[model samples]
Target: MNKNISAGWRDFHASAKVYYLWLALGWVEIRQRYSRSKIGPFWLTISMGILIAALGVVYGTLFKADLKSYLPLLAVGFVFWAFISTTISEGCNAFIAGSAYIRQMPLSRGIFVFQTIWRNIVILGHNFIIVIAVLAIFKINFLPGLAWFVLGFLLLVVNLFWMSALLAVVCARFRDLPQIITSALQVVFYITPILFKRDMLSKYPLLIDLNPFAHMIEIVRGPLLGEPVPAVSWLACTAMAVVGILICLAFHGRYRSRIPYWV
Candidate 1:
């Protein structure tokens, strides 16, 4: 067990040594995705802008919230949520999706995970432009909390690394898991306080308080929306990152070598 754990940690670190290779690969993926398209990746920004505008108006009116305030929140929330949700849900297929590379060459499995996160980071950059526009239109002062937003984003990336590691291994072994993860994420989306404020469920704070996704979203969305940093979210996410890393270390140590076979 100890040797396996050590090996897993070593493999994870070794993969980071080739960060540039995978990062470039990630960009290649984005470029290929829009190879012939004129607007390229900005289509993500345009689509997100449309969603935010349409949903913000409809949900704001339905919930009796002000558009000036709610639109910025929705825009930031959706951008972050899209990144988070896509990273996690797609992470299940990380190893399986890279089956060709895993079998044809001797490469670090961690590269695939990093590629997934990096690809989403690129997409997030595109989507975040919409959030900036919404904030500007609403006159929200996001510059004041820029430091916290960066910190939160870094922490979120840490969380995603561990998450992708674990899911990559598990989903490779269990073929049906990708579908299950998709369904579960869909359920989590409705429960998370993205479209609706947590205050609406004031009577049952646990709904949001106990949800890691809510905290994940809050840490990033809070600062962008000019809201105070939720200390509870910071602490919760930090703890989860630590725990997730430990779990990934153990899981990968025991199963990392078998990933290619499974795929």
Candidate 2:
């Protein structure tokens, strides 16, 4: 892990123009995502608004929950779920998607993984507006200490970065991984507390303790709900991130050059 970071640091510093290159690629990603749409980025806003409305009207009633009471939790949970879902799903193709560049250019392989994460963050930015709008309309009294939520978001991004690095290398060589990962993510969606309140786990406290996704989502939403942070879970996830980075770095260092051939 240390070796990979050292190498990455050297590579990053050696190139004076890497920022310009990454910025250009990031901008291109933004354009490519919205190129065919008429209204471009607003499509994200519209899609999320409709989905939330549909679920709020449909599932909220089916679950016998009040729209005003549950909509805020649902919206926030769904938005963060989108972040985790897309980052991993896209990470599986991060290397494959940039095959042309990997083969033809002398760019760092890490850049592609970073680009995937960056693009997902941009998409999250668009979807976040819908969450904020929903929270406002329903008059949900979210936490006033905004800094904690920001801290949680930064950690979430850090976690996604680690996941992307590992998956990008693994799926580069094993291309079918994307489909399998997407399927697993679908199952995770149901088990995650996206459509229900956290208190629903009162009788099933074991479920709360076992769910990694639950902890991940809670780190971000707990602050928003005026709840206290979970220090133990946060530390545990940080350890996982460290171990994940080691594994990913070992794999990436071994196969970084082979990526072009695989792609």
Candidate 3:
């Protein structure tokens, strides 16, 4: 058991040392995805902008929300949710998608997980343009609490890395897990406070309180909207990251060697 833990830590450390390789690979993926398109990755920005606008109008009316406030909130929530959801969905294929490389070289499996996270982070950057636009148009003064966003985003990424790592190993073996995860995230999307505010569910406070994603989104979104960062959110995300990483490390360590065959 100790040897397995050590091996997992070694694999994680070695992958971190080869940051250049995965970083370049992630960039290459973004480029290839938009290759030959005139606007290139700006297409991501455009699409997200369109989605935010459309959803903002529709849901804003349905909920009788003011466009001014609702649009900005929706924009921020959607952008971050995109990063979280896509990273998790892609994580399911972190090892399976890189089967060729895994088979051809004795590379650390964690490298592929890093690549998956980095790629989505790049996409997140592209989508964040819409968030910036929303903030500017609404004149939401975010500078005062920008520091909290930095901390929150870091915690969000750390939690995502562990999620991706754990899913990568498990999905490589199950193959069916990716579809299941996708379906589950669809349900979670509705439950999460993306399109609406938590106060809307005043009677069902537990819904938001129990949701880790709600806390994850709140930590970042709250600051950008100039709302005070919730102490509970910070505590939840911090505890989740620490506990999730430990659990992921143990699971990945036990199953690391089996990934090659599974893929």
Candidate 4:
């Protein structure tokens, strides 16, 4: 019998606990999200729908773009932005929020970091339905090819996990790190093709070349655009994942013990 599990080279049953923990964390996030809203999770769907309508009108007309084209981009970009921006901001307090658990339990620090990202993914999953609805409302043809889109999504999650681990450790150690991340993300939004197009990049080629968020957005958005991403981009992200994972591992090894204390 094969007993080696793939991810950590451990037993399958042992790693199964992590998946269950993800489920539990996701459940908690869902509950907390709706605790204040009367409509609960439906608030996400309704709010997004309204924003899409308003922004689609204003930005589309401002840019002289058609609704069919602009709305789809807006939907996908916002959905992806929710994941990225949420990961960055939430990661700053990931350990701090769970100070009691970190101090009390001999738990896998990696799992809690992963939990922060996974919980957001679950929320984003709920929000993707809104994207689909926006597509239908705007009459944009969305590709239903599960394999390609799912692969892109999985890669995005992988990147998030690595990022969350690294950011959580940093923020736990440096309280001001969260504010710096917020500032960086604000600068990134203006440059990203969110309310604009790749034309913005063409206008300033140097900006696009230097903007990591552009590459990050394309890694997921390219597939949704029916353009399977170029191998160069894919390879670059893979290399990034490797480097990020290594950094997180080093952080985990060195400071996982100190996280609760720092928090």
Candidate 5:
């Protein structure tokens, strides 16, 4: 067990040392994905802008929300949620998709997971243009709390890294897991406060308060929406990251060697 743990820790350390390799690979993926397109990834930004507009108009009316405030809220929440969801979904196939490299070279498997995450982050950056435009158009000035967004985004990324690492290993073993995760995320989307404000569910406060994703969204979204950082959310997300990382290390360590066989 200790040996497995040590191996797992070393895998992560080695992968971190070669950060340049994964960073470059991630960028290569983005370029390759839109190689022939003129606008490239900006196509994502355009699509996201349209979706945010449609959702903002439809749901805003459904909830009787003001367009100025509602549009900005929807834009930021959706963009971040897309990052979170796609990372996890793609993370499932991190090892499976990289089977060629895994078989050919003795590379750290964690690199694939990081690549999956970094790719989605790049896409998130594209989608975030919509968020910026919405914020500018709505004149939502949360510049004073912008520092909190940096901290929150870091915490969010850390949590996501552990999650992706763990999922990559498990899903390599169980091919069906990715489909299950995809279906689960659809449900999570509705339950999470992306499309609606948490306060809207005032009667059942635990639904939002107890949900880890809700806390994750709150730490980042709250800051941009001009709301004070929720102390509870910061604590919740920090605790989850610490615990999840430890769990991922142990699991990945024990199963790290077996991944090649599984993939």
Candidate 6:
């Protein structure tokens, strides 16, 4: 077991040195996606802007919440969710999708996972414009603890890396897992406090307390909204990150050799 764990760390260390390769590949993938398009990734910003506008009005009226409060929250939530959901869903196929490269090149599987993260992060950058605009419109001043947003976001990325690594291996081995993950995320979206306010769940506050995604969202979104950083959120998210890292390291070490055959 120790040998396997050591081998996995060695593979990851080797892969870390080739950051430029995966970073370039991730950018190239985005460029190729919009190679012939006039607007390029801006199309994502436009569509998301429209979706948030429509949902904000509809749900705002439905729930009788102030647009001033709800729109900004919804906009930020949508952008972060896009980053989180895509990272997880697409991550399941990160290794399998890169089978051609995996089979031909001597690369660490970690590169493919980073590629997936980079691609979504680029898209998230585009959506972030809308978040800033919404905050400005609402007169939400930037707070001193805004630095916590950076901390929370980096922690989230840590969790995402482990998740991508684990899922890439698991889904490569089990063909049906990608489909199951998709369905599970769909369910999670509704349960998460993105579309609704936490106040509504006053009777069952545990719903939000128990949700890792809610904690993840709040830690980032709270600072953006100039709200107090929830101590529980930071604690829960960090604990989850540690657990995810252990799981990913163990799995990668044990199955690193088998990935090529599975893919």
**Each prediction's number of clashing residue pairs:** 0, 0, 0, 0, 0, 0
lDDT of 2 by residue, 1-263 (tens): 67766665444344334666656687798898789878887787788889988988888989899888678778888889988998999888888988888889888877777777777888888888987787779766666847878877877877787788778878877877888989999997887788877677688876766777787898888777666767866875677667766666666766676888888
Selected candidate, larger lDDT, 3 vs 5: 3
After superposition on all CA atoms, what RMSD does each candidate show versus the true structure? Answer: 1.0, 2.4, 1.0, 4.2, 1.1, 1.1
Q: By the lDDT metric, which is better: model 1 or model 4? A: 1
Candidate 6 lDDT, tens digit per residue, 72-152?
A: 889888889988999999999999989999888888878898889988888999889998899888889866657889998
- Which parts of model 5 are misplaced by more than 4 Å? 1-3
Tens digit of lDDT per residue, candidate 3, span 1-263?
A: 67667778889989999999999989998888888999888887898899889999999999999999999999999999999999999999999999999998999989999999999988888788898989999999999989989999999999999999999998998989999999999999999999998899889989998999999999999999998877999999999999898888788889998998999
Each model's lDDT comes to: 0.89, 0.78, 0.92, 0.72, 0.89, 0.89
Off by over 4 Å in 3: none
Model 1 accuracy (lDDT, Cα): 0.89
Our tally of clashes for model 1 stands at: 0
Q: Pick the candidate with the highest lDDT.
A: 3
Off by over 4 Å in 1: none
lDDT for each residue of candidate 4 in 1-263, tens digit (9 for 90 to 100): 12211222222124246778756876787788678777777677678768877988999999999878788887788778877888878877888877887788776666666667777777787788877776677664547545666776777676777777678888899999999998989888888878788765686876766665666776777667555565666676677777776665555566666777898
Alpha-carbon error at 85 in model 4, in Å? 0.6
> How many angstroms is residue 144 displaced in model 5 relative to the true structure, after the best TM-score fit?
0.9
- TM-score of every candidate relative to the true structure: 0.97, 0.89, 0.97, 0.87, 0.97, 0.97
TM-score of 1: 0.97
Error of 3 at 115 (Å): 0.5
TM-score of 2: 0.89
Better of 2 and 3 by TM-score: 3
